[model samples]
Target chain A: MDIQAYISSGILEAYLAGELNEQEMLEVDRVATEYNEVRIELDALRESLLKYAQVESKAPRQEVLDGALKSIQEIEKEKFFEVLDDEPEVRIQRVNIVPVWTIAATILLFLSLGFNYVFYSQFKNTKDQLAALQSDQTSLANRVSETNEQLQYAELRIAHFMSEDNIHIRMDGLDLAPESFANVFWNKKSNAVFISVDNLPEPPHGHQYQLWAIKPGVAPIDAGIFDHNQLVQELKIVRGNVEAFAVTLEKEGGSPIATVDKTFVKGFLKKS
Target chain B: MTPTIESKISHLLAERNKEAIELVFTHYGSLLLNIINRVLRDDEMSEDVLQSVLLKIWQNGHNFDSSKGSLFTWLVRVSKNAAIDKTRTKDYRLSQESKNGVEVVSIAESISTGDEIEKLYAKQLIAQLPGDQKVLINMSFFEGYSHKEICENLGIPLGTVKTRIRTAIKHLRSII
Candidate 1:
């Protein structure tokens, strides 16, 4: 056979697809056996066509298989009866006076049904297992995100405290109160103080803890009212080069001037 | 135990082994369905024909020679033939061309649910073929139209249809 011409004709594609007539099929198969290229090319076409078909394929319902099996049984029953009614020579030749093909088909049919059941069950179990794993993964991801958020918050706090531009101010008790103390975290650039009322005594009713920023020979500036009862502001904003810091008990709102008699705890920003 | 399932599966199937038959059905059931559905274009009829095709594959398992082609290719050839046979029926041809006046959607959309459709070796390979080339393949392989019939339907010469199909498949040899 002129293999190249036969291949170029594209009839082999049709042939491998079983589209060729009997004569053409024989010719193609004969050449395919004789020539390696023809066989390989023919096979490749088969692979391509099947791969294409496989992609577009969908399974009929399991009932389709079950129904098919039942139909096979019906077919076998008819075949058995027809054989019993005719072909006496065939019956005598074969053992049990029955067509062995029918029995073999019946056994294969039953085996196939059993195999189908096993596959379907296995498929369901695998699907269920996959679903469970997916849900487990989702919950683990959520938990990881929650932990990440907390770690981020702690990191932010650590960064804020360790910032190079911040000044820590520790206030000791004045002569009237020896044990009272408090601390302030002042960011010099921002002119803001984060105050901690560590050991200051609770103020009397109708009075509040007031914070002050003082300069040498200058009157105190009312920084902010730090009323434990009525204030939620933890950081007080103040400005200027302060020589001293002080806290005093003031009236419910605040005092325009310092009432030094009620001075409780104080601290000055240490010079760097 | 070959690195690829192809050889091991081919071995199983060539022996008329039950496992091979089951494996083939599990793997290529949708493929057979898709090929038939593409040809028949009717779900119910396609399924009936699909069952029949599967039976033919099973009954004639010994006749299948794997050295010539992989089991999948043989199964595909069987499926396409079965589908094309259904198309040749008068009732099927009439319902398809006359009753269903709408231009059919792509084969990809019809076999919508299967995992195989996701891979769409069919869509990628055939869709890449220029418009007429793809149509020519489908008309011949899926619709069971002969080269003459395809040429007549498309009003092209016989040699054009034949050569186009040949080249298109030859092109796929490289791509696949």
Candidate 2:
């Protein structure tokens, strides 16, 4: 093949596009290896295509490439473990001997001290252990006290969260369970809807509980979807005059339009 | 192992030479991204492609034959190929073009030259192409659209799209 002519023919473009058959690819690879001119032409062609592509190229967001680099680092770390496995037994033996000698020396020292060392070491060890235990207990108690304070603070926040003067909608569980109830803390000022599903039962796999705000005569708008994993699901329900809030069992990602048959809970907003 | 290219790469690998890897990244990362962005056009997808390209380089550095081409060329090819493959996917092309329309335009306008001569060269080459060719090249290279998509959008045939792009590329290669 006239490698220079072959490369200049724009077949490399087709090659880059994966349009070439196996034989053509092999032929191009062969010529590229054999002739420097072929390789140079091929490289030039690729570069030109790349340059053209670059003009159209958008700057990739930094975060995406950072994620890739992170994964690459992880892979490289894994490869390090593999390399460690390839060490010779002699090297392993040399590495093992130091720890063994240190252990033996410590045993010898303990043996030399005999009963005197035993009693003294036991007393010392016990005292140190007791000190550690006492410290651990004190720290644990402090942690418990701190956690209790945090718990109280969290409770205060929850109480405050529920108390804010906004539309409160109480959803009574439907045929699924009459006793079960949920609450919607609609903060119109913040345009935030917090769904408290504390009382509701877990939906079946492939199903999620969806909240909908229904106006007097209009179709219900999907507020958001909540799952058992979430104690409270925060949603943004855009301003729409609605008479009531309803909950329905929908597919995992929520439905665009609500289905009545899957209705599990309903509640009318309390008028201020 | 002797101090061949393979050995050097292996040593770098064994040492977990982040500096060397980072050097490669800082040097070629943007250029590679530029190539990918040319093909995919959507910033996120292009970024995804750029990552895959870098990962391939890291994993397969030993496979690189410097005797064949420079590392930059190899990276460009890999990035472009990955971007092209991603663009060729039905879901990627459809979702990207629709969801990322305005963002793509803004990104194109905001592309920083950052005082790099190569970047300037690339910018000049792109600028020098005829207006229609430039648009077609931009759509084809950056957005990762097939010639058919370009043709359909511009009301041109596939053959014209391919030839004009090929000619534009040839012109660029000559100038560069």
Candidate 3:
């Protein structure tokens, strides 16, 4: 978001007045931590409010301070309880209100307000439900990575792989490793390549399988290195154009150049 | 700016120093008294409430964590709670309810105005605020109302209430 827009959201002001609910307060805390200016602004608002409070401050009678100071030194109650001057003053005074009509009006107003509050809360609950649904709609797949949403993402990936914009390079194991196979989901437009291991034998702990993109006579591009235990791995960075993709066994870090002799599985685009 | 009183608060509490309580009372006594009076509006009661609040601060010294908030914020919150308790007392509430549903803020304001020191302090900062912003501050801070409550009472949308009050605070901050 625009920093200025976020700063102007008035969330900070609500935060200062303690008007924000728990969720909103957490948001304010997070925002204040991230933005230096927000913390500064929050501090300034607090200082200004404190000063205002001080302006309205009235000094208690001197006797009260004496009582307070006595309480401070001795927290033990029994000694002060019997002798000290602290007493619960019967300070309330009853005022006779002669206006019966206003009381009747107040009762009626309270009844109507009570009903209005119920309806307003119901409306608020419905709005909350709709907001929850909208959030689900936007990030439905992201919410569950280990369950139904993961299945959805898997389906989406498969559909994209099979789409017309994608080039599917099927790799079968070489003569030395004939049981292995893999597939590359190569999206040429975005230059993204995801590898799904079909039946490749796991390389030993100290070794790895590295994918390379070769343009025939040119030096092969290092697609990426993958952990032997991984079922699928997406190369971090991929550039446009490649004639063939190949996997080779290499030392753990992978080699700058392909280990040409160890091409366990290889595939080439049918130059169209 | 001088050092924040917050940095020294935890030390004072941890040491359980009597002199420290005196220092805190000298600096923040009026502020806490004002806050309680805003809620309770009785000098007689605010006196007792302020003592209890200060006693709580002394007793609960171990609970003060500076990371949670500044010392002033925490003190004001405790004062507000004590003031609430004062107002919630059966006698006080019954007496207050009988006052024709009108609050006694004017009486409290008059008392405040009589204190030249307090009046000057109040006017110095609060006078700098625009009329609208001053009212907003009064409702939000002194009356302890929420943003939504302010919106409902003022007949404006919540967004306008938030933005206007915030911008006012921003302008207030600049002058301070």
Which is the leading candidate under lDDT? Answer: 3
Residue-by-residue lDDT tens digits, candidate 3, A1-272: 56678778877666656565445666665666577777676666666766655554434555666787788656655656744444423222112233456788899999999989998999999999999988887676565555677687778777777778788899888996898888887887777788988887878777789999988578888999986566767785566668889999988998999888988999888778
Model 1 steric clash pairs: A57-B30, A57-B31, A58-B30
The CA lDDT at A137 in model 1 is 91
Q: Best candidate per DockQ, number?
A: 3
Q: List the residue pairs that clash in candidate 3.
A: none
lDDT of 1 by residue, A1-272 (tens): 68788778777767643455545666666677689788777656656665644444434556556655566567667989898777776656775535578888899999999999999999999999999999999999988998898688657545655788667778889876769987766677777666667777777889888888888778998888885543223456777788777888899888889899888888877776
Interface RMSD of each: 5.5, 6.3, 4.7
Position A142, candidate 2: lDDT: 99
Worst 10 residues of 3 chain A by lDDT: A88-97
Clashing pairs in 2: A56-B142, A57-B37, A57-B38, B38-B141, B38-B142, B39-B141, B39-B144, B40-B143, B41-B142
Deviation (Å) of A74 in candidate 2? 5.0
**Runs with alpha carbons beyond 4 Å of true place in candidate 1:** A55-272, B1-16, B22-44, B60-128
Model 2 ranges with Cα > 4 A deviation = A2-5, A16-26, A48-67, A74-272, B1-42, B60-126
Error of 2 at A121 (Å): 35
Model 3 in CAPRI terms: which quality? incorrect
Error of 3 at A39 (Å): 2.9
Instruction: Please write out the lDDT profile of model 3 over residues B1-176, one tens digit for every residue.
Output: 21345556667877765555665676666556656766775666777888888788777777877666556566767877888888878977776776643544543453334454344436765556665665566666555556776676667797789888877777766766
Across all candidates, what is each one's fraction of true contacts kept? 0.36, 0.32, 0.52
* Model 1 DockQ vs. reference: 0.15
